[model samples]
Target: MLEIKNIVKQYANHRALDDVSTRVEQGSIFGLLGPNGAGKTSLIRIINQITAPDSGEVFFDGQPLSPDHIGRIGYLPEERGLYKKMEIGEQMLYLAQLKGLSKQEATSRIKHWFEKMEMQSWWHKKVEDLSKGMQQKVQFVATVVHQPDLIILDEPFTGFDPVNVNIIKEEILSLNRNGATIIFSTHRMESVEELCDSIVLINKSKKILDGKVREIKKAYRTNTYRVEHLSHDVQLASVEGLFAIESREDKGENTALTIKIAAGRTINDVLAHLLPIVQIHELKEIIPSIHDIFVQQVTTKASNPLISEQE
Candidate 1:
């Protein structure tokens, strides 16, 4: 339910976002992916109205982004901070009220969150006494307590241990399930694969890719397959439309082979031609991970000294 349209932002000698555009669907988790200096933060700030873009516009739901939309969005930045002397429950209540909740409502919501996240015991503790990860949990609670229609989280899993990471992940999924749309930004491509329905990858201030996660993975399919069969010994080249035998292993009972399809041919073509000589057993196609696609695409876009380090 957010649309970033041809947005551009410039700071002194650097152009941060350059005509970047993407759409995030309502009630779905959308991933905002980019390496350092890829203008991702610029676009996020514009969406939050923390910084104005030099040109272009953002649409929230069906309307142009406006001050009224502020209460409908929640943002969690990478940096975590809390009032050192403030009690966790008190701070959370204060922040929730600022998001338009009444004191009673804030108190109720904070209690639920504290219980769900298993932080009820820490509610009376001062922020200064909390660990880094604990403070992150507090920040997350404060950010989304009002249940905004759109939630933007940058590096949300940074300080979370694996168990806590899964906790946050489940909470995010729950929010989306309750009709909130999410814009998640992180360096972890695996999380994107798990959480995002769609994603946009920005590199050098450009939208290099945007598509449904499954569709994007399908587009990058290598046409590589793993096959296992009990067969007569045969020449590898005899099969038509088979590019190469990428790997082979001889088990005592059955032989397994990894094969690549020739360009512009279907797996069926290989199977049909090979089934005559070999007793077919199993076949599976290989698909590239989002991380693989991210690295490959961004790497080909630039030759800068630091671009190689981007992923």
Candidate 2:
């Protein structure tokens, strides 16, 4: 539903974004990931039209992004911005109307959201009177009341307790299930693993990785496997084809081992030799986590110019 094409942005002495391009599909949760000062916020601003890129273009729903598209997009910035002195109900109503909802419609939606979020008693309380988490809830309500087609959330779980975080997470997933395209930006790799259908990782003002989460993880696999076997006297410590024995744990009467296979040896090859030595209980591949891939990519880009260019 959204396409960012070779967007470039520069400040006086630094390039914030350099030839970054990625796409977010319709009704999908897309993750925009990067560390601090990695140009993620700069790109988000460009998408929200809070700032223009130095070069390139953004397209929404198969057309060039325009002013009219603003009403179809909902943005919840990393930095919270709310009228501190305004009552919760009043602020949400005003913001919803500004997004093109009629006054009556805004009020009805606000009431429904408040009831759903269990904030009915806090309606008349000013934003300043609420806790950070409470204020965050209010801002979230304001963001989605108009039911925009695209919702861009930056650090959306900030200031939320675990309970409230789960609540918002459920809401975000519900929104996606109801046909909203979501762009989630955060440093939480675990959240990306759980919620994002696909992800784009940016570093040093460039797009480093972009793909379906499962595909990316599978692409980065290192042929690691975890094995559990019923063995009390077996000591196959000098396995020749093993790259490394990552870990060994004693589980009751059996031993569990995580081993990495050397190049050119398959898991079946390893199992063939192990089955004669011990009764195999369970075996599973060790999939790389998103954090592992992020660190590996960033480090590789910084150290290897050829790899970076090829990537």
Candidate 3:
């Protein structure tokens, strides 16, 4: 639904986005991940047309990005943007109309969302009167009330308890299920792992990684496996060629081991060696989490070495 081609943006001395490019597939949850000052916001701003890219092109739904596509995109920025003095319903009506919604349609959607969010009593309340979480809920309502084709969410889970976070998360999923392509930008790797089908990692104003979540994790796998077995006295130190035990934990009656299979060695080889010595209870390959992958990639490419690994 969205294609960013070699987008470049600069601000005075620093380059916020440097030749960055990625695609957001239609009806899919795409993650835009990075640490502080990693050019994620710059790319997002360029997509929103808040600032023009120094060079390169962006295409929306097969055409060049332009003002006509503005109403088809929904953006919920990390920084809250609400008129604190205005009534919740009134403010939402104005924002919706600004996104090209008619008065009657905007009012109906506002009512539907307020009722869905159990905020019916809050319609007449001013933004200044609500707590931070309540205000976030209102902003979320404003974002999706128009049901745009493309939704861009930045740090969308901020300022909310777990319950409310889940509420908003479910709503995001519901929106995607109904055919909205979502670009979810956040430092929360767990959310990316759970919600994103594909992701692109940006660091130091460049695109570092991009692919399906499963495929990326597969590419990073190192043949490591976790095993839990009933064997206290088992010793594999003498077996040098099959595998290397990375870690071992004792659980009273059982022992858990993390081992990396050596070159030319297979799971069957490790099992063959262990089956006689221990009664295997559980065994599974250890796949790297998105958090681990994020840190590894960013730190590996970082020249500063002190970059914040904000997974």
Off by over 4 Å in 1: 230-240, 249-255, 301-311
**Which residue pairs in candidate 3 have backbone atoms (N, alpha carbon, C) closer than 3 angstroms, thus clashing?**
none
Candidate 3 regions exceeding 4 Å error are: 302-311
- Residue 217's lDDT within candidate 3 is 86
Give lDDT: candidate 1, residue 5.
87
| Model 3 C-alpha lDDT per residue in residues 1-311, reported as the tens digit of each score | 99889888889999888887788898999999989999988888888999999999999999999999999989999998999899988999999999988999999999999999999999889999999899889999998999999999999999899999899999999999999999999988999999999999888888888888988888878899998888656655526788888898888888888999998989999888888877889999999999998998878853322232332
lDDT of 2 by residue, 69-158 (tens): 999999998898999999888888889989999999999999999999999998899999999999889888888999999999999999
Q: What's each prediction's TM-score?
A: 0.91, 0.94, 0.95
List the global CA lDDT of all models: 0.86, 0.89, 0.89
Q: TM-score for model 3?
A: 0.95
Tens-place lDDT per residue, model 1, 200-281, is 9898887788878998888777788888887465644534555588888886567788888888988888888877877767
Candidates ranked, most accurate by TM-score first:
3, 2, 1
State residue 35's C-alpha deviation in candidate 1, in Å. 0.8
Error of 2 at 287 (Å): 0.9
